[model samples]
Target: MTTSPLRRNTLKLSLLTLILMGFVLSGCSGEGESWNGKDISGLMPGLEFELTDGQGRPVTADQFDGKIKLLYFGFTSCPDVCPTTLQKLGQATESLPTEAQDDVLTLFISVDPERDSPERLAAYVDFFGNGIVGLTGKESQLRQLAKRYRTTFGYEEPDENGNYAVSHSSAVYVFDREGKARLLIRPDLGVEEIRQDLIALAKADT
Candidate 1:
């Protein structure tokens, strides 16, 4: 049977689409890479920051260049989300193989500097785990970092007790060893799923 011109054109287009899809699938399965969280590679810039650690020392992203870092922003006074997320992260990192445990670090940055002083921040992070580092800075510094990650925080009005709540992003931003953004872990992800993603990213070639 002879094919019409329109039929031939349609067949050619379909073949081209299949070829393109093959390339996409190949890319997805490359190096056996897989992530349970949102893959954000190249969607954001590499980690960069200048803040104070829990020990009252100045710190920058360069200090963590060779470690897989999880960046989270929330206040210490956060009634639920902050503590819950930190506990999950602590458990996840602790579950890693002893030799690989040190390869992961969690940066818990407090958005409420007014209430979370350096000393308080240090104690708060210590409650989570040793691998967790609590960092905070001036409001300006926190603002800039949040903007870099495309997240923000705001304060609610204080009650008669003069206590207020701060609202911020609950997702954890994961960065590879070289500090490039890689995955975004939602608050709803299980600890095991988070652990697997961290292991894969840590084992990936820098």
Candidate 2:
């Protein structure tokens, strides 16, 4: 069979289009699988702040640079999630290898700064672990930090008895040594799972 010059050109163009489409589709597939059985990445993690730690000294996110940082956002008064999550984190941190543990930093950032004063946050975190750092600041500062991290938090009105609650994201963010968000662990994650992931992250090169 004889093929015309126009038919040959048309075939070449069609093959080129198919090849380009395959490349695009393959890239998308790989991105989709990057988070498979792992935490989501892409969100940036650190924000500049002059928050006060449990010791009443100034602290900034920069202090955690060049280490694996685990940041948890919650209030001291949280009836359930905050305490439980911190405890889990304590357990996880305890399980890390010495090298990994030395390279990890844990932070508790309170969304309810109105009531979660530095003293309150410090005591709360200390109950879970000695090395866990608690961060609290002016409401505006806390809100700005949360916004930078795309974390959501709000206060629920108190009932007739004047008791209130806070609704906040329960995901613990994992930041790589370079301060880039690398993964998220849900509140319900087991201590062992969190420990394993943190170890893997600490060992991962930037």
Candidate 3:
């Protein structure tokens, strides 16, 4: 009658996703100014993290100040969701006015550091677009960032072929230029909705 590590992690991740999804639903109920994405103005803290970039150099959230950020968590090995989400974000940023496009940035943080090396992350992100940056770090740093955003991730046991699956929140966290949390971009949102939300956030108080 003992729970395995995989089961424990999965349960914790599922619970965390439910809790954060509730916040997203409430934020999207139009409690304040309307936004295409869920308004998460005060649900989480401003962006802050100490991690390694795709180049294997250290980075902090403060280094990205003054640009609107779309922070997402996933792994490069992910067969579907990660690539799709990154592509959607890339498209959303590209749809912005040429001038406004540069104002938005997508930070793709990979939680599966065991397999996602800095070089692999760099190449993976490059396939997306210039507006996106790849990031990862030690498990401890990753956990801190995930915890800060009220999300969690877990890994499934590997099969005989040495392949595994990862469970992670598919939501993207949007922050304004000043690094204040602003919106939760749910996976169900389309490119246009995400684009519009990015435009508003990028142009805010500028």
Ranking by TM-score: 3, 1, 2
lDDT of 1 by residue, 132-186 (tens): 9999999999989988876667676677999986767777989988999888787
Q: RMSD of model 2, in Å?
A: 15.6
lDDT score at residue 168, model 2, on the 0-100 scale: 68
TM-score of each: 0.84, 0.77, 0.91
Backbone clash pairs for candidate 2 read: none
lDDT of each: 0.83, 0.71, 0.88
lDDT for each residue of candidate 3 in 37-116, tens digit (9 for 90 to 100): 77888778999999999899999999999899999999999999999999999998898999998888999999999999
Among the numbered candidates, top lDDT falls to 3
Error of 3 at 170 (Å): 0.2
User: Against the hidden true structure, what lDDT does model 3 obtain?
Assistant: 0.88
User: What's the residue-level lDDT of 73 in candidate 1?
Assistant: 92
- Candidate 2, residues 1-206: lDDT per residue as tens digits? 98754455445545543553343344443543233123445535453567889878888778878877788888888889788888888888888877667777778888777777777778788899755899888888877886666555666557698777666666677788877777667655798888878776765653
Top model number, TM-score: 3
Q: What is the lDDT of candidate 2?
A: 0.71
